[model samples]
Target chain A: MPQTGRSGCPINLTLEQLGDRWSLIVIRDVMFGNRRSYGELLAQSEEGIASNILADRLKRLTASGLLTRRPDPKHRQKGIYSLTEAAIQLVPLLAHMGAWGRRHTRSSKELSVRAELLEKGGAPLWNAFMDELRHLHLGAPRPARSVFGELQAAYEKALARRARYAQD
Target chain B: MPQTGRSGCPINLTLEQLGDRWSLIVIRDVMFGNRRSYGELLAQSEEGIASNILADRLKRLTASGLLTRRPDPKHRQKGIYSLTEAAIQLVPLLAHMGAWGRRHTRSSKELSVRAELLEKGGAPLWNAFMDELRHLHLGAPRPARSVFGELQAAYEKALARRARYAQD
Candidate 1:
């Protein structure tokens, strides 16, 4: 059984753990591919989260078992962040949120592209995405490569497009 | 076309509008039972949202097109709050959130029961619930008596259970 802290509502508890504005963005960055260091998250976020708040949210997220941090293998000074199993379970929630937002909010080309893919992919896409991450990061059994090759390709394409705009 | 106020990412915009802790709770109260009167909201909520903040949220929600407020027919000083189409759309989101929380968090019996019902009923239940509200507030056609009857039974059961443990 999961632990109940104070409130009895599940949504309230989830909010207590991951409701802040910055936390989900951080998770998004990590899930999407920006997991190298804190600086990357700070620079890439659209919300312009403050440095202190970002740092605090990262620490809280780590402590809450949503994410884990390790010293960067390439650079001792940098911290490499990765999602735990608990955090990966959030893919469905994130996908739904993204789809909802896409339906209601003004669409950016990039956001709409991502949302469209997420909508089509649904739970299978989310599960496959999680499986790939687990295989890559934690040495879990490699899922059938065919399952995620297209997703990986699309994600890479998105990343390249982002890089061009990011440099300009 | 949906208007994106900021970036194209639907999740970010949604977060900007409905991500706050209190906003969803306020919406839940209005959708579930709490209708008009500021005092009733304050009295019922266990979170004890600050009056100024609650007032501000209510105003913002109304301005944002999620809720509507009208002069209460019974009490001139009171404003009867009703959910707009946009707010009604959030029933599924809230239901999903509640379901996720129940699966992952330790919650009270009352909340757990509600979550279980929501999970079992899914979108159909959400639609039925919203249709009932529309009829009550907007004079839409009434739904099947059985549908309303089941919803009322569940809602009343939850309320009574909550009252047993109500704090002063």
Candidate 2:
């Protein structure tokens, strides 16, 4: 399909396809948070994504081939959203973005934990995480290394640290 | 200053700062296209940015610390804009973004040449380019290698190829 974006510069095209305030956020949820259902995305939204905006972004992302929606087998009426290969490939970009934010923005310790790990771990970590995502979302064989576990463990540690600090 | 964005997730924070449609485009022009002044940016806008939007984004980017503006020595009435360390560091993210678009989106060959080279050259090229940007925008000493020359040459070659293809 022809890109109807403002320009054909690859960055502009990428932005045209996915530059909204919430599109990447939704993909982040799918890729990292493992939130698949519309309800889960809305309820678990750390950014407090409004339901209408979430619904619209879901539709747009699905149309743009970043996501695919299928009927939740357990509930025929509910749909599970999965990231497409396009969105799956966004790991490095997301890593860099997170790294920039960690350095520049004011973020909660628990939230910045993932960005810190991703930056420190670099490409090997990003690739391993991508492999694990392929296993989870694309049904690829599970990789022996679970970078996801590593990242999640770090985040949990930060959360525990915050709890202790709070009690103090 | 505290982040006014919805959440502190690094990705979300980065997006909150730079996620708008035109913010990065303006930066791209300044970084890659060498369009610094308001006139240069407005006149060379690839996406044909509206005058008001360009004006607004320039102010926002300047206010957000991604860009700095100063009265032009040549023309005191017109201000020259330069990228800050924060914006200069966006090279990797922009590179990944462009690479993804080249793989996934429909783009004109000429405009995508830089993205193609960036993907092929990888981090080394990005670092060289960032060094070049620092020299140009931040008054750093010029680097030994000029990835900008390589990227611009590739784009020119592609533009000529497109012209020849059209003539055929």
Which parts of model 1 have CA positions greater than 4 angstroms off?
A1-6, A34-36, A136-138, A145-168, B1-6, B136-138, B145-152, B155-168
Best prediction by DockQ: 2
Deviation of model 1 at B165, angstroms = 12
Residue A83 shift from truth in candidate 1, angstroms: 1.4
Candidate 1's TM-score: 0.82
Please provide, for model 1 over A99-128, each residue's C-alpha lDDT reduced to its tens digit, 9 standing for 90 to 100. Answer: 777776675656556666867986677778
Residue B117 accuracy (lDDT) in model 1: 83
Candidate closest to the true structure, highest lDDT: 2
Write candidate 1's Cα lDDT for B6-93 as tens digits.
4556777888787766788788777664455677887776566689988988888888888888988888888878888777777667
**Total clashes for model 2:** 0
DockQ of every candidate: 0.52, 0.88
lDDT, residue B11, model 2 = 92
What proportion of true contacts does candidate 1 retain? 0.62
